[model samples]
Target chain A: MPYGYIASMKARPGHRDEVIDILTGGADGLRTAGCHLYVVAAATTDDVTIWVSEVWESKQHHDDSLKLPEARAAIAQAMPLLTGEFFTQETEVRGGLTGQP
Target chain B: MPYGYIASMKARPGHRDEVIDILTGGADGLRTAGCHLYVVAAATTDDVTIWVSEVWESKQHHDDSLKLPEARAAIAQAMPLLTGEFFTQETEVRGGLTGQP
Candidate 1:
């Protein structure tokens, strides 16, 4: 089974720019960690909420990235700007039709 | 058929408390609007990314909450504390095992 993580975030209103800067950087960090199926989709509306979808080659690879400087830097930089509870989870993706027409 | 949304947000480091305040409020607002399968799971680590999992009775109902004071309030209050791009997506859940163990 493939391992993936889903996490949500909300940006401070006027500071949306700063938020995006770090988020883009965070994505860069994950890329170096070999994150696959990584999709960072910003919300369409003006709300601060965001969606982070990532599929890793394996759970071990995902866990290994925690030691990387890029990952740690993003976390350190992100500490002061969050306004609410940050959510994250690791799950096994199961089931879905893939029939091709 | 049902509708669900997944969004991600990251909190500024030291303000985790303030962030949780607004997030809990946001969840309250969502519940009033009749969200189903709403799971607001906080990340286990010090990193800020959050995961918001919500299932609506229907898409229309989910959209209806946009007008609620609580929803808007959460957004306004949450603006300055974020440090990264917020991601959101409407998706259809497909597949999984349901057999009794």
Candidate 2:
């Protein structure tokens, strides 16, 4: 079973693109560690809001990903641009197109 | 290009499973209108939190799906169980496994 993570983040005014870029740049590296899906999207309704949906092979896989060098670096780079107002949801991915093999 | 929507919802007290059920029930109907993915996930960290990730062929495809009877019915059913603390992000889904042709 895959683990699903959905996080909502808000960037400081004018830093949305920067946050997205950092997220996008780190996405490929995440795939090396059983990250099945990592989709980052900018909100159409709110300029500073962004959403990230991820599917990892398992909970451990997701937990281990944060320890990766690229992941850590991306987080450090994205920290300043983030407003720190975020909510995270972790889910047991039942099934979906993104979770498919 | 496809439209991506990520929404975070909190269930009212203990209504998490019910909300997920309503969302899951509505997933198939959405596909009729070019909806590429509709993933309903239950948060692993928070029992009352649910996440929904959607991909549609286009923005119009997403909007039009809302006008469908099934979509409307699902929304109505799920509304009562929700805490109304949800945040939504609309994205221009550039590309992803789920959004693939």
Ten-residue stretch with the least lDDT total in model 2 chain B = B92-101
What's the number of clashes in each of the models? 36, 2
- The number of the candidate with the highest DockQ is 2
lDDT of 1 by residue, B21-97 (tens): 67665554465566644444445444566555555567788888767887777778887888767876785432121
Residue-by-residue lDDT tens digits, candidate 2, A22-47: 88875656666887777777778878
CAPRI category for model 1: incorrect
Interface RMSD of candidate 1, in Å, is 11.9
How would the docking of model 2 be graded?
acceptable
Tens digits of lDDT, candidate 2, B10-52: 9998898888877787665566678777777887777888778
List candidate 1 segments past 4 Å from native: A1-101, B26-29, B94-101
